[model samples]
Target: MDPLHAWKDDFRREVEEVLAARARLRTDEKSAPEEGFGGRIADLVIPPAGVYADLREAVAKLKVAQDEAAELRGRFDAKDRALEREREARERLKDSVSRLVLALREERAGRVEAQAEAKKARAEAEAAAAALAEARFDADHAAAKAEDWEREAMARLRGAREAQAQLDRLMLESDAARAEINSLTARLEATACRAAEDGQRAEEAARKRDAAQAAERAASARLAALEDESRAQLARCESLERANQRLAADRAVEAERLVSEALVRAEHEARERAKSAYEDGIEAARQRVEAAERALRESRAAEAEAAQKARQAISALADFRDRTHAAMDRLGERTRAEREQAEADIAAARRGEAQAAARLAAEQARRDAALEEERASLRAQFEDARAQVEEESDAERRVMRERWQEQVQALEALRRGFERGKP
Candidate 1:
């Protein structure tokens, strides 16, 4: 083929491509439905031209097309710059979204941590409540025990008083027996003297003397029996006193042992609980740190991927630059309008995101406040319960001590009374 013909054919193909590009741009504009300048640009139609008669004419037309293509290329470059700015804006929006997502994830993590802490606090509160209940129960049990001891002591006192009364009655009986013996001895002496004076009635006097002697013997036997009974009663009293002393000693020792055991057990449990809590906290902190490191790595990877995608888009746009010249001419005004709309849309989206973020923040703050308030209330309740338990325990102890003292005093009084009556 002739060289000129080949040139003409190439020129024709370029023109056709330009026309196709224009058609495609018009179609794109129609699809988007712009108005005013952008609309007019899209609506403008280029008529198809007939084939040129000669090479020179075709060359001149080709030169004109080249000039128009250069202008289009310049406009395409401007549009490309605008597209780059829009891409930057999109990248910023994506970064904002990523930050928002990261923030939401952090908020979720914080919420989980707070919930865990709340759960731990609740468990601690429950443990404290159980301990308080146990303490109250122990106090009640001790009080009941003390009351039982007091009742036993009182019963013993009543028995001692009755024994004392019995001893006094026995002593009175002994005194009467002794008086009778003395009177009998005086009567016998009188009868014996009268018999010595009256020899004629010696037989009657001897008989009377024998009867008197029998009566005196009977009186002496009765006095000996009374003396034995008194000695036995005194021995019984001494045994009872020893028993009372032993019971009081046993009770004191038992109370001291119980208190010491309770204190040691409580101290041990508290130390164990503290150690467990500290270990759990350290483990939780370590887990959180690991999770944070993992999240940071993930975020960095995501950022790098986003940057890679942006670079790929830039390379694609650069590749499209040559083909987009014809379409760029028609797209100039449309791009500006689209940019404004995109910016407005982005602003609206940003505003919406900001509002959502604010609402989430407010909700988070409110939840934190509520959790704090609940924690404070629980702490106060626990403290109050602990104090009440302590006070009740102290009061019970004091009461027990006072009762013990009273018992001791009563026992001493009994001992003194027994001593006074001893002989």
Candidate 2:
């Protein structure tokens, strides 16, 4: 609990003290300038319902959300200050009220003691006949004054004790007791005035009563009536005293109820304030948590770029592999074509060598046949020329033989002649 709010008073203050506290009401914080115009006016013109009701009204009128929030913050701060001032006022008012309640109690005690003293005085005066008249007169004067003061005191008590307490019924009963005492005192005074006025008559009647039995009987009857009236008044006074005691008890119970209610209201308000603060803290924590989640999302925002680069690298690698495979296939095909062309060239060279060898063998056969035919013709011509030469030589020899025979005859003759010529 706040220190100021913890204070409580046992009873109300005296009348003058209550008047002073009432004077301070105009300067209470509920009417402070910081509050809205409508709120301040209401506090001045009427009682408040709740502390923040006017602030809530102000928030409802704002069109912008930000302005509404700002106004609410300002109002909350003002309410805290108002609460502090309320605590101080409550403490001061309780002190003033406590004193007032105590004064009322003191007044009641004085009245009860006064009544008892008057009763004792009456008994004493009746016992001493010498001062009876003087004592009765003095007692009646004191009773008259007490009754008048009682009336005034009860009226003041009503005004001093506001609805802050529940002892109203007790006050009303007190007023009734005061009125009953006033009526009883008026009857006693009137009886005394009548008795003094009839004193001469009473003496004359006494002389007549001695002279007659009927007169003495009437005097006894009048005395009896006066005693009965006195007894009735005494009974009424005792009943008033009992009622006063019962009202005192009821006042005690009412005071206890008032204190307990104040404590309960204070506790409830404190709990509500704490709950509002906790809710504001939870909202701040939630905003921080959302910011953290957003930061985490932003950190990994480039995943698509990295994935695209990886795909490009994979495509390039596949294209390089395809190009390498195509080059190898082309190299293998060119090598096979070169080998086939070399084999075809070798076969053509062998066929060309065989045709050249066949031509050379035919030309050698023709040259050998021509040489055999030329050799046979030259041998036949040489044999024919040799026979002709031999025949011609034999015919020459025949002519020579004839000539030689003749010439032998002639040679003998010529030999003789040559011998003769050589010799």
Candidate 3:
């Protein structure tokens, strides 16, 4: 198939033909001596000396061409070795590039995961913020309720104090009334004893009636004036009794109202009225006692009747005191009950406020802990993502630089191979 091989084949055939012809000549010379015609024919067929010289020159050129070809072949082998090394280097570069690409993909995946985590952190933070806001709102609401409860408790406490003061006043008035009743009872007993002691003296004075007629007229006039005063006092007592009844009815209504509403204004007004009524009743009783004393001193002829009237007055006063004591006792019981109820309500409200405050504090603490933990987690994630990105970037830059250097070296090798290939 090759031109060089064909040429070699042709040269080999020529050398074989020459050698065979020479061998035949030797055989003929040995077989027949002094063959002049055969020798002359052989001499005629053989080439000239110049022709041999030309053949030798051609042979030397062929040897030089073979040496050149051998040199070319050696260079080609060196080129092939260089090419093989380049191919191996390219394969290594390609493998490195594949690995780099895979690393890049993995980095991208990591970035995506980091982004997702960051997003999740943001969502959780937002949720925490919302929960914290809600907790704050609840705390504020609880604070407002506690304030309202405190205000209500204060108002109720004031009311209870007022009621206690009223009760004290009533107790003092009751004590004063009892003292007055005792004095009235002693006066009544003294009056009855005086009336009995004067009974015989009054009969003895009957004979001297004419002699004491002028004195009796004066005493009767004085007695008339005293009677008018006693009548007026009795009317005043009846009016006072009617007023007391009205006040009692009003106090009853006010007490019921106070039990239901617990309004400060209403309770205050009721207390003021009851205090005024008590004061009025006490003043009336003192005036009646003074009027009875005046009547007893000025009316000598009517001393026994006066003592009887005094006894009735004492009886009425005792009855009034009993009624007042009963009313006061009932009012005190109701007031105590109301105060107890208010205290209980206040205590319950305070307990509720305390519970709410505790819950709010716990929620605030929990929210703070969650927020702090979330912040720390986010900070750590941010640092890790930043570090990973920096490492990947550095790796990519190094790979690119190495690849560029490899490409440049391959190009230089190719240029040198081309230069060596030239004739």
Best by TM-score: 1
Q: State the lDDT of candidate 3 residue by residue for 1-423, as single tens digits.
A: 121343345557978998999999788767766554555566658688999999999889768655655554355355445445654554555445444444444444444444555665445444444443453454345445534544453354344445445545655655555555455555545555676777765454443444345444555555555555544544443454345334434543443343334324433554565566556655765675566546544553364466567656644543332213344455346545655775576577657756765675576567557656765787787567546544643564455346435534543453343234321
Q: Give each model a TM-score.
A: 0.56, 0.22, 0.35
Whose lDDT is higher: candidate 2's or candidate 3's? 3
Which candidate do you rate higher for TM-score, 2 or 3? Answer: 3
Model 3: runs farther than 4 Å from truth? 1-44, 49-52, 101-116, 185-423
Compared with the true structure, all predictions reach lDDT values of 0.62, 0.43, 0.51
Stretches > 4 Å off in candidate 2 = 1-207, 210-220, 295-423
| Per-residue lDDT value at 27 in model 2 | 59
- The TM-score obtained by model 3 is 0.35
Residue 332 lDDT in candidate 3: 45
Candidate 3: residue pairs that collide? none
TM-score-superior candidate, 1 or 2: 1
lDDT for model 3, please.
Answer: 0.51
| True lDDT of residue 166, candidate 1 | 66
